[model samples]
Target: MVFIRWFLGKCILLINALTLPKPMLRIKADQDKVDKKTQFFTLYQFEACPFCVKVRRFIRKNSLKIDLKDAKNNMANKSELVNNGGKHKVPCLKIEKLNEKTMWLYESDAIIAFLAKETELS
Candidate 1:
């Protein structure tokens, strides 16, 4: 079962890489603003997770420049996700707004929605 899952995960990753989506075009100034805003956001994910891939596709399509943390392999990232995020889950988003408490958001759909609304990329 583990081997099967790993194989499927690799296949999914390969397909995703092969059929990359085109990013939305934005003027340099506007894209720079978006990039600056995304500086406080970090996405914690397993590379091969389908949901993570979905969110990644959205980020790529929208041209968002959020940072990615490998929660599956990186011990520190995994610990942060499990401790601060309060769960062991992929596609988790760490939101750190200025003058506001940090938030850990889960679910690929919710993450995508929040990013779309925040970046105004949808």
Candidate 2:
């Protein structure tokens, strides 16, 4: 019984490692679409998520001024993201619109591209 349980646990771990879920990407806001006067974009992410890392690096490299939220810790922010984006994924971009509404965006590639184009850092 013990061996069987251990084997099952190992299998679960292996599956999680091998089949890591892909990030979600929705809503692409262009540079011209966003206002430059906005203080900073907000990012919701975890420490271990690679997708989050990519966005952070790009924002840092380009010297973007944005707020950071740790999804693993903050329930309010996390719930807001999940409610708005419909998924609890890291590396989500929150763009503040001219109307004072927050926009949620996912996917590493698209986020990087949008930030690059918006900040003229690409």
On lDDT, the candidate that comes out on top is 1
lDDT of 1 by residue, 1-122 (tens): 99999999999999999999999999998999899889999999999999999999999999999999999999999999999999999899999999999999999999999998889743
Deviation of model 1 at 96, angstroms = 0.5
lDDT of 2 by residue, 29-101 (tens): 5333332533667888875466776676666555556788888778998898898877998788888867676
Q: Each prediction's Cα lDDT score?
A: 0.95, 0.69
Model 2: residues >4 Å from true position, as ranges?
A: 1-40
C-alpha positional error of residue 81 in candidate 2 after TM-score superposition, expressed in Å: 0.9
**Model 2, residue 36: what's the lDDT?**
51
